[model samples]
Structure formats: structure tokens, C-alpha cells
Target: MDALPDTLPDAPGERLRIASYNIRKCLGTDRRRNPERTMRVIKRTAAEIAVLQEADRRLGDRPAALTPEVIAQASDYTPLPIAKNHVSLGWHGNAILVRPWIELEDLHHLDLPSFEPRGAVAADLRRDGQLLRVVGVHLGLRTPDRLRQLGAISDWLATQTRLPTLILGDFNEWSATAPLAPLKPDFNVLAPGPSFHARLRLAPLDRIAHCDLWEPARTGMLDEGEALRASDHLPIWGEFRLPG
Candidate 1:
């Protein structure tokens, strides 16, 4: 396996790499539902933390597309407490996965208002004594609804005391800038690149928003040939600098 760059914190309280991917229910460009291919692309990111969108079936029992067993065998990662039912996976198709060594402190679900089912997953994690809040989300398609969802997320973030909060996932927005004015002055939004439609690579639908505690050192989309065949959207990752 090709090793991704070091995504771990440089020192005890340094930095880490966080990534986001909309796996499209593990359906590959070849028109086959391949969990192995999806996990292969995820492993390629070499991210310490990964936020996933569309991790479950859209209808029916909403069974998990990426089962825990497969994830364990494919990568050194584990899913956050986003799944409720034994067979279900994630909250409204949003899920969070963290490295095995990242200590989890708490986990919660943020229900966002939408014409369709939409929500966010919040994970309070500790690494080397540093606490980090990670929120995985998949916003709505409509502009107005997306704005409202962003507002709901912003309001919830206001009550948290964590310094470095990371918000990431499939935003479903087609703009270059995230329309999160309310979160401004407190959060910095980053779009790695055009991540949607991996074949054409036309839109920046995936993004990461973070608090001021850390600045992203580098960010980009993983569009390898295997990755493009794994899912419809390419995985995006960011390396952040630890606060001094």
C-alpha cells in the first residue's frame, strides 16, 4: 500500500490531517457497489480523521453501506457513534471516522431542519491531552435550506467551548466560498478543490470549516485513478498547524 503523508500531530499538541468524502453509497464509477474499492480510496487519504457522507442506503432499512467489519479490515479507523439501529449506519447519511488511537470523549447528533432528512454528527475527541470537536455534516441541496442548515450549525457551535472545532463533509454547495457569514470571525472555511463528479471534477461540493485555533497548512483533493473509480466524489484532506 502507498503511504500517505504524515497526518499525525507533529508534537504532543501540534497538528493533524482531517478529511471528508461523499462515498455515494459505495457505488463505483463502474456501476458496481464495491465496498472494497471505497475503503481503498479512504485508506489512500491517510487521514487521522475522516468525515463521510452517504454511508447508508437512502431508503429501506437504511442499512449501512460501509459496515464496521469492512472498515476494520480495510483501514486503521473506526466509526463514531452516529449509527442508532443495529443495521442502520449514520445519522441522515453523515458519519465520522477517527483513527484507532484518537481517544473519544463524547459523541452527539445535531438534527438540522431540512425539507429532506439531514443532520450532523459531533465528536468530542482527545489526542495527547488536546481536545478537539469534530462535526461531520451533509447539507441540503436547496440554497435556502443549506443556509438554514448552516445557521443551525452555527448556533449550536456558539455554545461549545472547544477552541479548535472542525466542521466537514459534503456541503452540496456549488460556490467557491461557503455562505457561512454568521460563522465568520470564528471559523475559517476551506474547499480543497472541485471534488464532485470525480470523472469531470466540476464542483467544490465538499468543504471543511474550522475555528481559529489552527490554520490549514495544506489542502487538496485525492483524484487518483483508483480514487476516481471508487466513488463519485473525490476525497479531500487538510493538514492544520497546532496553536502556539
Candidate 2:
């Protein structure tokens, strides 16, 4: 693949590398637990911020899928401080990991309206003297529930005064354009390409979006051979130019 443009035209700004991945609880196709392999995929992205889905076991106490020592041994990324419940790594299996340079100001979980158990984790982070709010979510599987969950998220975003807000995770939906109507006015929903079913990659289930405060420089899917084996869904990443 050819290299993309290194920089965007006009006013230059801080380049932020953002990524989103669904690790499938670190269980690969081989039917084995491999946190190291999952961490390797995340490290390969070189992302400053990555919102992870399924960072914990689904049953039996729901222990953390990725631990602090494992994260430290694999890369420089640190998981944000989220309210812990039942030894899980994150709230509702949605976790936000950031590079050491990114400092967390505040964190909370949003209870999304859903027929099933669904939620979002929001983090106020400061990077290079710039404040940004990041929301990591996993929407409900049903269409109607997803729409209502998005509406609830929109109501929450309205309360936030932050300019450059990012929402990333496994949306579990195929039609990205229609579902994002609530945020279309302010956020730019990007289709980095199909990221789900790593082997087939027929649908773009995992995605990332940002408010107009930042401009997208480059966006694409991280579908390496190793990434495909790590989980059922491939990771998607985007490089954004934050206003200076």
C-alpha cells in the first residue's frame, strides 16, 4: 500500500492517532486465551487512544481480559480509570486506553436505553495541553434499540461543551450513515472500511467518529493477517488533525 499524505493542507494541527478494537475477550480462532496477541495488535496501531470492546469475560465474575501488567509489558498505553464492578476491567465491557502522555481529567459511564445490557464510557482527557472528551460504546444489537441508544447519547453530548468529541466502539450495525443522524450536524461519522468478521470482513461493525473541531487527515482499517487471527473483528483507526 502507498503512503497517505503526511499532512493536510492549510493550517496544520496536532496529529492524534485514534483506534478502536473488539478483542472478543481475547479468545482467538484457536479457542485459546491470548492477551499478548491482542496487545500486539493494539501496539501495532501506534494509537494514542483506543476504545476497546469486550475487555472482560462475559460470565463468571467477568474478570478483566487485559491486566495492568500485561498492558505495561506490551505497550505504553494505560487504561483509563473507570468505576469498577465485579472485577471487570471496564464499565459494560467498554474500556478506553490512552498513551501515557494523555492525562485523564474525569470519567463516567452512560446508561444507554436498550432491551439488552448496553452502556458507554466517557472520559475527559488532556493531551498536549488540549482537552478532549472521548466516549467508548457498544450499542444494542436491535435496530430500534440502537436508534434510541444513539438518541440518549445525543442528549448526553448536548450537555458537553467540548469542541472535539470522539465516540468509538462496536456499534453492531451495518448502515453507519442512517444511524448517525442525531450527530450528523456536529460529528463526522467515518467509514474506515469493513472491520467485522475478521475472516470475511463483510460489514464495518467497528467504527470511530469525531466532532467538527478536528479534521480527518487519514482513515483506514487495520486488517493485517495477525490482526485477523487475534479476534473476530478487525481494528479501525483514524488520524485526525486537532485545531492548534
Candidate 3:
């Protein structure tokens, strides 16, 4: 692939690299240890915006900061999690982290069943002086559960005003028949196939999809091997540039 332009739009109408990953609660291949390893993997991905899945809250608390890198490794983001009781386990859901150059306005999370407080994170990012809506979602695992989750997200997104949007994350779908169908009219699933079960290298569970003013310069899984040998899922990254 060829190199994309260095500068991406920032004000309301610009382009950027946006990704999503299911850290599996930082569960390593060995099935032991979590936090530190998760941090390592995230630092390596180095995306401008990242939507993380399986970010469970301990004692029902989100991570520490709001920075993209901060939220990728820790549970720090805005809106300060009002409550946590949607799933059977409680306090596990999605988080969106954006780079400093980019700003997200109006952020919130949706509640889903089957998964532990499953929800979607939506934000209005400033690009090219234009506002773009980027949504991050971690849907339920079970087919039935996820079906409901998909409906909720599709319905919710329909209410938004027309704007570029990117919906990303560990969608939990292992086949080409992804639940992203309803979202097709607005945004497309930027990646090609399966991306989960990180250790086995099967399934494209983690993803980066977007719409308006952007082109996929390139995209794939991150392989750190050791620096951050944590999480059952591997990180999917993409390089995007502004559309002519």
C-alpha cells in the first residue's frame, strides 16, 4: 500500500484513524493477568481514536482519564458513567478514546442486556470545522441478545442529524453476515473479514468503519508479540486520509 497524507482534517470536516478492540478484559492467552498487558497492547496500536470492548468496571468504576491513550489502557472517558446495572455481571461495556487534536462533543452510552451493561458511545468530533458523529459499540455475544442490541443501536443512530459517522468495535460477529446491515445506508464496515480469538488469529472481531470525507489508506491487526502480550483479542488498526 502507498503512504497516505500526513495531515488529517481536524475541524468539523476532516479525516482520521479510528479503531475498535475487545480487550477481553485484558485476559492474556495464558488466561492470567490483565491490566498491565492491556496497556501494552493499546500503546502499540497508537490510534487517534479507539473504541474498546469488554472494559469491565471493578467495584463498578470506569478507568482513570479521558485521553485516547489513557482510555485505551485505562477506563478514563467523559460523561462519568452515571450507573452500571444492565448486564448480569454489571459494569462492563464500551469506551471511546480520542486524540487531543480531535475533540468529541456530546458523549453518552446506551444500555443493552445479555452483556454486562453493554452499550454504545457516541461523540461529535471537530474536523475541518465540521462536526462528525463517531459511535463506538460492543454488542452482546449471543445471537438473540445481539439482535436486540443491534436494533437498539440502529434505532438510536437514526435519530441523529446527518453527519459523517464511524461505528466501530468488537462486533462479536464471526461471519460476513454481520449485524451492521441496518447501518449500511449511513456508514460501511471498512474492514474485510473475521478478527477475533486473537491467540488463534481467527475472526475480525475488532474493526474500524467510517463515512464521509475519508478513505481507507490501509488497515489490519497489530502484532506486538511481547511488549503487550495480553488480551484474548488482537487490536485492529487503520490509516485513513481525507477523500478528494
Candidate 4:
């Protein structure tokens, strides 16, 4: 796979690429449920860690839309066991996939305050003595609920050990500032570009936010090849230089 562009020169710090995508339950914009195609788009990102929203179906048991077996066969990533049940791949459809070489130190499923069943997943990953924390979320539809969910996430993070952290997913909020204000105090939130309505590309619904320990090298949206037909929201990625 081709390497993602980086603005920074060679440095002593570790460089990591993380991506966020809303697979829409593996139902593509073409109106077909193709998990393999979704995996192909993810593989194209060449990300070390990928946080996915709507990874599982809504009704019934909320089984994984993209099965672990398929992901294992398609790429080197291994899905973290954050699901509440045996069949689901994530907690409330928020899932995280990382390279198998990365060690998982801790994991949490955060239940947010909302009228709908909304939640987020937090995972501590370690490699080569460097530790990183990632939180994957899919916020509720209403603006009020979105703010509440962000507050809930902040409350949950307040109790955890500090580390280089990244918060990513389909935020579901159209306006950039209002709903995400709660996170502004601590994180450097960035929306790479417009990724929603993948066919035409209008709104910037997907985003990545990180704390002070990491410096963003570059950020972009995957819009080529399979990405155009993969889902309604294109995958957004960011490369960050980890603290030495």
C-alpha cells in the first residue's frame, strides 16, 4: 500500500496513522451490503488504528456488520473485543481495529446520557514503550444529546490515566463548534474536510481530535476507488507524531 503523505521530516517520535469511518452497517451508497468492499476501503487507508461507527446492525442482536473473520482475512488488523455481547463487534456500534502487534492495556464501554442507545469505546494501546489511548463514538442525532454525550465522554476520561489520546468517529453534528465545545478545553479537535454524502461530499461529519501529547502531521479524507461507493460517509484519517 502507498504511504500517506506527511508534512513533518524524520523525527525521534513515533508516527501513527489513525482513521475514522462510518460504514453505515456495511450498507454501501449503492444500496448493497458488502462487508468486503468496506474492508477494502479501510485497507486502502493504511492506518495503524481505525475507529468505526455503525459497525453493527441496529435491530435484533446487533450482530457485527463486518465480521471479525472477514477483517482478519482482508487485513492485518484485529478488532478489539469491546462488544457487550458475544455476536456484536462493538459497543453500540462503535468499534476499534488495530494492528495485531499493538498491545491492548485497557478497554472501556461508556454508556452516554441520551434518549437513544448511544455509547463510546475507549482503549489503551501500547507498543515499543509508547502508550496511546483511543476513543470511538457515534453521537446521537439531536444537538442537545450530542452535547450531553460529549460531556459524558469528558467525565469518563477525567478518571483515566493520561496518555497520548485520540477521539474519533462520526460525530453526527453538522456545525463544527457548538456541539464539540465540551472537548475544546482539552483537545485540539479537527475536521479534515467534508466527508459526508460521500457521493457529492458536502458536510464534515467525521472528525479526529487529539490531546497535547501528539502533533498532527497531516489529515485527509479517503475519496478514491472503493471509498466513493463504500458508504455515505468517507473515511477521514490523520497522521500524528507521538511524544518521544
lDDT of 1 by residue, 28-71 (tens): 88899998888888877878888999999988889999888899
Q: Candidates' lDDT values, in order?
A: 0.84, 0.81, 0.60, 0.86
Q: Model 1 clash pairs?
A: none
Worst 10 residues of 4 by lDDT: 4-13
Worst 10 residues of 1 by lDDT: 6-15
What is every candidate's alpha-carbon RMSD to the true fold?
Answer: 2.7, 3.8, 5.2, 3.4
Over the stretch 37-141, how does candidate 4's per-residue lDDT look in tens digits?
999888877778899999999999999999999998887788998988999999899999887667899998898999988889999998666888999989889
What tens-digit string does per-residue lDDT give for candidate 2 at 34-62? 99999988877767888999998888778
lDDT of 3 by residue, 160-208 (tens): 7766667777777776556466566655676534455665667766666
**Candidate 2 weakest ten by summed lDDT:** 4-13
**Superposition error at 203 for model 3 (Å):** 1.7
Per-candidate TM equals 0.93, 0.92, 0.74, 0.93
- Write down the TM-score for model 4: 0.93
Candidate 4, superposed: residue stretches over 4 Å from native:
1-13, 177-179
